[model samples]
Target: MARLFNRTTQQGSRTSLPMATTLPMTLFMALQSRKTRYRSTLVVLAVLLCLSTYLLARSSSSASHTLLHKDMPSDDQMPVVFEEASHSHVSGTARKHRKVHKDREQVTLDPSQELAAISSFLASLPQNVIPLSVDPSVTVDPQLVLDFDTRSPRAAAEVQHMVADVWLRNPVFLYSKLYSPASREVKAMLAKMDLRPAPTIIDVDIRDDAEVLEPIIKRLSSSSDLPVLLIGGKPVGSMKEIRLLDKSGELRKLVAASGAVVDGSKKKQHKH
Candidate 1:
């Protein structure tokens, strides 16, 4: 029996040069019990790797998309890409989007500036009324004349009455109606204003050009010793200077406030 026990202990103690190492009982038992969990973990990891690869391939399909993805700017890096544009530029849709944004920033949105510009444009038209606010405290100089040579039929009549009402009442302000008579249209029209003629009417007919304008200028400048403003060859008044612009009213009011007078007339009477 002692000889049999000695042989059994030697067999158990001897380590063998086996193909695979044998696990201890505790480790072997744990692996055997959790075999299903280990298999499931491996399968899930393989699926995640395959999905990530497929998504990357799908995003790089287009050439532009591929370029955008490569060397992309992160929040911690530069945002703008300013590469020299090759002959091949950005898509037409991208250019149009940039232009639309630029034009929106350039447009002026103020409502009052638009309205004032329109009003000033309309006021410059023929027969458009100008409200003459006279400080009657200013004694009128008889040398300054308001002359009308408007070619429009309605304009001549409208201007005649407008100037007369203001000029005739003043002690020294005077007015005259000067125009061509080649047309019976003008003659028939002038007959309407004379319906209530005052002694203060001075009518001059010019068949020639600004030869008529020259004399009127000479008369006003010689008589008043003041600057004369002409409108289409008719002497309008004594003014320091005339400026032509889209918004003459603002400038005119500025001049008036500074005690300087301005005439909006387009023509300038020749100064001797």
Candidate 2:
């Protein structure tokens, strides 16, 4: 009995010794695992912080750009003088100030009155000057191409009559615009020549039928330019042609040939 009890006690002590050793090893492995997880969490936080900072910086820069753009002025908001300067510099063409007709009375005529006026002006021209037929090679001004298809039949007819009265029927016609520098220059030049039975200067821009008349004038002149000069119902030319004619001393001859008298002491004067 004593020997059996000693063997049982030895086996129990062996089992307890192994359990005590394994418990400390398990605890050490658990502590190492927790430390590794904590390190990984810290690295993840650092990366997130860097990413957040970069995003914030990008957003701030975008916001600043937006604000700057919003503060910039649009073309419409710019001063008139500045706008004028910009436009004048675009084609290097000198922009003359509109100085004519500031004190002149405004004349508005009805369709019938307009027709009568045109007829009277035609009658006043010397009998020797006749309406010349348009040249076929000269393309009609695209502006004069009437969109009769869109207009009421009656409206279209009225416009047609007006166009004929102004361009086709009249022997002397000056197609101009109120604000055009070239038109003003042409007028100034014509004034100096003192053409007898002066050409009717129609400022299409100020006409009530501007939408229709403007295009017709453009088409009849076969040009998109302002200040179309017509003599004997034929296009004499725009400002450029007039200048050329004047330079060569042929303008007076052309005017006289059209049965118009040029009598002005200021005939020798020219526009710079």
Candidate 3:
């Protein structure tokens, strides 16, 4: 109403009697109820204040997020300035393609030095004795079968040497195992050493001595041109014995009596 009156006044308008008179009374009554009106307005104002506070908090949070995430300057303006600064930090480096040369080594050997070295090595070992404990009548075949297991330490070592020797001369010589264990080692023993005189020997250990002895005797007597020397009551094979006799002296008469060539003074005495 005051605004209305002020507008009216500004327009230079005159108020009529009825409006002029009623306006004062209405204004007076409104003024008298001003406390009640003010209280109702205060309640509405408080609700509006709460709504404003919520809007302000929301706006503040939105502004904070925008400030946190975005560049500080306005969108239309340059956001940041940059400068290419010199970074002259000191550093050390190593190269990979490096070459190194090594000198040639010298090899030297002296007769005295070699002799001393051999003597030293030989001195470390005990005497090499071919353990001659096995029986010679075990088997006629090179495959030595005895009453002893060849796996025993003494037997294995001896047999290893014997088999090696057998192969060294007659590679056809073979080996076999025994089913039982006895004092005899089959490897060191032979049916007839006179065939091949092996220094590494196994003595006779035949269970049935006669059975073994008879066969050897028969082989000897069956041949007219063969004479075998029986040593230790065991008949030796003339196949090996004859070759040995040719190399030794006394065996020439036996070699001649058999009507075989006496490879002794007779061989030299006979004309070509």
Q: Pairs clashing in candidate 3?
A: 135-204, 135-205, 136-204, 188-202, 195-240
Runs of candidate 3 exceeding 4 Å displacement: 1-32, 71-272
The residue-level lDDT of candidate 2 at 71 comes to 97
Cα lDDT tens digits, model 1, 145-256, are 1122122223335444544343323212122335422223323322322322211222323322223323432443333422232222223333332223112444334333
Q: Tell me how many clashing residue pairs each candidate has.
A: 0, 3, 5
Residue 262 lDDT in model 1?
A: 38
Better of 1 and 3 by lDDT: 3
Q: After TM-score superposition, what is the CA distance of residue 107 in candidate 1 from its true location, in Å?
A: 20
What TM-score does structure 3 among the candidates reach?
A: 0.15
TM-score of each: 0.15, 0.37, 0.15
For candidate 3, give the lDDT. Answer: 0.35
Poorest stretch of ten by lDDT in candidate 1: 93-102
**TM-score, candidate number 1:** 0.15
Q: Per-residue CA lDDT of candidate 2, range 1-272, in tens?
A: 99999999999999899999999999999999999999999999999999999999999999999999899886444322322222211232222232222222333334333433333332443221111232323432211122221122244454545555544344456778899898888788778778666766777677544565455456545677767777755677767778998789787787777666676334535421
Please give the lDDT score at residue 52 for candidate 2: 100
